[model samples]
Target: MPLIYQLLLGLVLTLLIPLWPSNTLPFLHLLRSLTTTPMMDGISLAQKAQLHEVADLMLEIYKTLAAMRYIDAQAINPGPHNVSDLLYGLDPAVIYLYSILPYIDKDFATNTAFFNGGIFADFRKSDDVEQGRDPFYGSPSEENFEDEDGPYMRPWVTPLSLLGNHGSAIVYDTRQHHIWIIDQEGWSSTDPALEGVEDGEPDSINRNYFAHIANRPAGDVLRDMVRWYRELKELPGGTEYSDLCWDHWDMDLKSLFEKNGWPDNFDGDAFLVDQAREFCALRAKGDAENPLGEVKKFTDWKNGKADRAKKAQEALDAAQNLNETWKARFELWNAERSVLRNTEELKKAQQEADRLCPNGVCQRPEDLPLWELVAVQRELGWKQNDLSYHRDWAEKSKESDPEEAKTYRAAFYLAEKEVATYEKAYEAAKADADRLCPGRSPKSVAGIKDLDQDDTMRDVQRRTELDVILTRELDALREWAAQIPPEANEAKGMADNQIEGLDKSVEDNQAALKKAQDWIAEEKEKE
Candidate 1:
């Protein structure tokens, strides 16, 4: 893999990251003592293991997005790029001045589904090679000499070969600060080369980012990668559509497998799934715990008088700059940015946003258009449903996973807050319509296609939601009743009784749905 594949991934900066576990490394502590400056714009951190996770997730997302695009457009003229120059060069931020993959030609496929010729070749493998290492701490499988004990742990060292050929890069961001492993390009990461450092731990972590000086924990970076992976991986038909896992990289992975002297049959289809299943299986059997124990706390070994005062002073000073550079609402743009590969689309959007709402600022109702608010309202309904779903999950999962239940509860709370915010925006939107465009219902809003025939159709929405729930309940009851053994008389009777009740529920819901449909028709006819 080269820089082009990373560009295709949208975040070349995050494709390869150096990681430090949350409570382990002295990096964060050392920073607390020394530097008072925040990370530079678009500058963040990541670990090698985290990079591997990101690589797996992003390749899958690219596959899904590519498939979706194949159904519509026949225009993908991607080109190769050597981004390592800009990333590790004299003035790193100079990249934004020009487009990297300046290709003009386009291609089409004849039912091959995203096979626009050689364009998909580079996205076949992932590795961080010839980049973040020095003196090459020989391959992991290599034998140790008289001075060594075993195969050393290949941690992402700070000292690196800055001029190493065509590996990953630490690129710039238009907005936001969060570390990611970007431009992680190499083949045969199917057990590629590894390097270790004297000061680093002896584990098989492939890459790390900005480890030379930066000190944020790699844990959060890894967590976000997982979340991103889960979100995009679920977007496609998913494991039910199992071929998506390989992202058409099966051949490349197979080649690497063969070259590395591994098993003959290396199926990329289960590349990610196998890891998840195997990890869970191992974890279920027994955790691979650290024999010497893990680092649970940080020790400021040089806790001098000046160091303590400096730490206290920095903490006090940080209070003044709270909420200055970033806010939570504007967060996650980096994640979204990673997938935004269309420059023309992004440019048009940016231009349009600048025209309608300057600097991403809008005067709520006045600046809010009817269709935009309608869209917002429609999204809020989804969020409202999400709020309810998370609430249900939080309650239901408590018996199975209390920790996951807490996560659901937190998501539920967030959805509630999000819904509340949307509700306020909606009220403000309605008030705007009432004040500015008087006597106009949603139907009166010209050119808005997403709206129902009339506002009374909201009842149809509610009734449809009710119908779906009742139908699901009926299906569940019938399935349950069928599962009950005839010999288990008491249990069978209970199932039969519940199924009867659910049958009535479906009956009543169908009636309600019909009524709603009738009302909507009547309202539209009257109009």
Candidate 2:
């Protein structure tokens, strides 16, 4: 037997054997003690002894294994001593032992059951067991299991054949009654048995015991083990065992542990504080990297752009309103000016009518002979020889024939005065007609036989001239009212064009601004 089993047996003998009665046989005393002791309330003496034997066997198997290796069938089969066959022969007893030993010492049974084998073996290899051959030689197939990934078999066997040469081990800390699976490749158990496994109760061992180690090299495995050991030591109230199996590993993981600023003896409180600080730093970093801040910035820019667009639109509207107002004012001013111009023209026409016809009579009332007027011009002619002879004859007659000379002279003077009066009237009429109708002419009175015939001819001439003047004035006013002024037309065109251009600009800018706002809103929603 291994020294560990010897020591355990020695302890049991020393601590529990003495409680038996001295009067009875050693076996009967043990049986009585087992039935009576609170620690062995449910287990019989025979069951307790079987549990101890299983624990010793498990210890012996563990002692024979290499570091990180399990005592599976491959490690013991086809050898000088086949522990696998031996275990198979005692399978029924072993099962009974596991079922009953928990009533006496649950931790011992649990540790022995797990470390001795059968529990954590690979199910794929165990399928070979049905063929009456080694359990390590078959492809994994799910036949009776509810889940393809769940446990496949329940027969107790060494885990070495399941693990092969490159896998890890499941270790049981007998002193602490704690089970930990340390596989090079990470492993986890969701089996119902390991759910709430705890110390002192073998039934609970199936529930609470579970652990894993990531796939790594030997050195890394050692480092991880050291780290776990330190962590366990840093737990509240600390662990009971100080010298764990880490010393047996050749790797030095102390530097690796200290490199993270965690001392070998670091407490749990310090670890918690460090983790909190790291969490806060990560949160701040996330805030800095988030795009929500950029979204807000773009939103601000969008608002500013919207405001600018609004103001621009308002300015454009004001400009358009001012242009319309000016146009209306100009139209009103033109209307008033036209009215004033018409009034002035009417006043000038009235003054012209008074100058041309003072007493409503357009001609003189006297009548003169056209022949006498012509004869006078001939008699008084200075450059003509006939008028000189006529004047001389009249002078001679005055001496020779006074009556004849007197008659001649009287006719000549009267004719001359009549011609002068007619000439003055013609000039005045021509001037009045020209002033009232600049491009018009008056009728010729030279051809009129009745110079004083109730002023009919003179009235006709004045009326014709006045009609021409009034007609021309009316045509001019109509022409002025017919069309807009050149400047006003140009101003109106500019206003229309400006308004159109501003409207287009506002439309385009509004669309662009709306697009920007929508994009910003979308981005914010994503954030």
Candidate 3:
């Protein structure tokens, strides 16, 4: 109905810029769901978590360099000196990073990894201040927007034409080099469209909305920094460089961690750690034997994405072609029926057909399982969206306007009823799809031919030639839904519940699946 192929043919083209590959995107999706969703009870704040992620890798180095610069210039309290025990228990490294995060000076450090050495050198311990959320939600007075008071007015937030430009530029590059993961707290998280966005899909997220979807996970960014730091420590001739780093940090930054306290960042959960390796071949990126599993998943997903799109196009073509065939047959049928209607033959034949089949029957298309699934899912999605909207309106107005609330509530239930109808339709279609192979989901049922299906008696009035063509074409549609490798199906099935939330169990399962996929792909390449 209504050019279903147009809906089937999605906006599947890859951006000139690379987002995460499909497999890796899901992994990143899980991580963001865990750490970033707002007002999450018992979970860590995304900003703090992001800060701490890259903290161990480079915090001391930043503090050391900042202090050295100030000391060289004879400045007092030149860096993160210390916080009193009465105040807070954060490590000096984290305190330092948090303290200086508001700097938006044109002269801000622009090192490869956004490592700060030059600018913070002049900053003093006395200058450190807690930057609450005022700056992002600036008042009409414009003090917060210009950051005139937050950073000691060091960097003017003016030049009205280029608002958020200085900060937005750092969002992605910092992640690529694996240093600073600019937090999304004051940025895209506030977007109204992002409200109620599924934790599993970052499709509408726009951390750098003006430019592109900055799809890199802040967690992965920090992980990358950690990996790089690990490599730096182990690399040949790195000791000399580290000695210099140690010397600069020793006076203040390093001592602060030893003297005060920091959040526990040790990866000591041995079971989870071991589980990760076994599942995803989870080594640090660029490991000799098992490289980054995320990258492997991404590569496979990317290479296959175009192929999947091609399959979708083939399906679209088949659907349109079938429509054309159906149209021709339909015109002939109408002409024959019209001619028959002019005579007494029409009534008797119709009576006989009616006797044979109560309602006018025709063979259900062989492709009904998946093609009907597409249509059912489409209707289901629309109904679900309608239900969500009405439900939300009902909740919001329940207290303020009881009558309006009741109206919306009624509408909500109506939508819910429609949603249930479509969902049942979808499930029925999925159930009838003969499994392509054992363990494959109905979603994975492709255009494989099935010759044995009954076509003679039931729905005997008409059966079109297009049905077989539709089945063959629908295979492309099937793959479009379940693009994950066949090996991943088990992991995915196991992960379904855990993946819904921050259940640690599914993390390991996904890792294992990624690991299996990586190994399988590697072996095939070798062959």
Candidate 4:
């Protein structure tokens, strides 16, 4: 037989044989020494020593196995054979043992099961096992005893149909009464429909029946499962798997198998750590650029603030000019009112003259004809020779007559006052009315035929109308000025608030940048 076959035979015998009774320690020890002895190659002493050490380690594993309770082939229901039938009738125990034993005896090179793209079944032939037969029971095809919901129907086992299939290792833990299906990608035994279904029948199989061992890029849970197995086995001297056991076994066992190597999808933890470091460096770079970003933002805010200030000043100047215009209008209005008042007095005097003289004889000096004055002198009965003397006497008498002289002087004064008042009022009203109405001309009081009633009333109405217009314009100007102050204040306030907020933001960013710098410096020092 080949040396590899001898090794395989030895391993099978070790698993099958029960430990000797506790009383037969010496005999058991001798039997183990003879059977578990290393096969020495025809090499130098140093090479021989190394082989012996490896042999000794294998012996230790055997001793640990001796203490463990053997799980007989019969105890495994829906067992390995049933699973292996899907692998074209390969022995499941060979696959299980070949998967785990290499971790202990690193020099063990032969795999006694299907792995990668080849089968290493030299010691035992699978040709005798019936193909496409029910693996649970060695029954004929016509029996129809296969269950639809059994392990054979599971989707995870589909890989077993391939000729050179490599799949997950299944281990039955007799102590826990549960089977642990260890796969790199986690497995779910519960039907997908029954997921998160808590309120089901008492016997319903949920996540409780399944144990998934996911090996993520960052960490592998299979390592924990291996540790749990080791604890259960309780190997002598508390032997531990290597530090790299936590890493993916496919990666850890790269050198051991001929075709099996690290998984193609594996991205090592170092790559992730480097990626995280790069991310941190990028964040630090972003922090370093914060000041410049803030500078640009502050520049925009400054420009906006300047624009708002300029707008506020313009608003204030517009308000001031409006106020000046209103003041000039008000002064003009006041002067017009004064002229109207004087014109009203002149009108009242004319009415008084009409009351004092019902007849048309009491005419004003400007209204009297030259013949009327001479007739009045002739009625005073003075001869031509004594005309001068009489005229002097008549003038003295007139001065002496208080009522006549008072009436004469009042009428003359009234006519002169009316002329002056009308001229002043007309000029003022025309200027103001022209400004207000632009193309329209003011109506003249002199054009009215009824001097006492029509002219007086027209003059009063025009004054009132002009007063209304000036008052309304003044009110609008006041309203505009009133609105500007609040708007200017609001603009100023907004600019101030913007600058203040920008300052605060810049300060905050600077502080963050400082902290980032400190952190970067600290990280550098550590490096």
Highest-scoring model, lDDT: 1
Q: Every model's Cα RMSD, please?
A: 30.5, 58.5, 32.0, 51.1
TM-score list, all predictions: 0.25, 0.19, 0.17, 0.15
- Candidate 1, 243-334: lDDT as tens digits: 33233332233333233332233333233223222222232122112111111111121223335445444544554432321221112222
Q: Candidate 4: worst 10 consecutive residues by lDDT? A: 235-244
The 10-residue segment with the lowest total lDDT in model 2: 236-245
- Pairs in steric clash, model 3: 279-511, 279-512, 280-511, 280-512, 447-475
Question: Between the candidate structures 2 and 3, which one is better when assessed by TM-score?
Answer: 2
Model 1 alpha-carbon miss at residue 378, Å: 0.9
The RMSD (Cα, Å) of candidate 3 is 32.0
Least accurate 10 contiguous residues by lDDT in model 3:
153-162
Rank order (by TM-score, best first): 1, 2, 3, 4
Which runs of model 4 end up more than 4 angstroms from their true locations? 1-172, 176-178, 182-207, 211-509, 516-527
Residues 1-527, candidate 2, lDDT per residue (tens digit)? Answer: 34465456556666766676776556654444444443333334444554444344443433332111212222222211222433333234333333321111111111112221223232122232232122223333543334443232233322221232323343322122233333323334212234343323222212212222112222222233334334532111111111111221321223323444444344433332222233223333333223333344444554555455555445545555555544554344334444454455445544543543344432322212221232222222322343345467679898899877866564444334334433443344345445554553222322222323323334545555555544554454345434535456644664455445545555554555556556656767999
lDDT of 4 at 28: 45
**Candidate 4 lDDT, 81-153, residue by residue in tens:** 2222335433333333222221211112111222112122211124312321222222232322243233331
> Over 4 Å off in model 1, which ranges?
1-182, 185-368, 450-527
Q: Decide which is better by lDDT, 1 or 2.
A: 1
TM-score of 2: 0.19
lDDT of the candidates, in the order given: 0.38, 0.36, 0.35, 0.33
User: What ranges in model 3 sit over 4 Å off?
Assistant: 1-53, 60-81, 85-219, 223-527
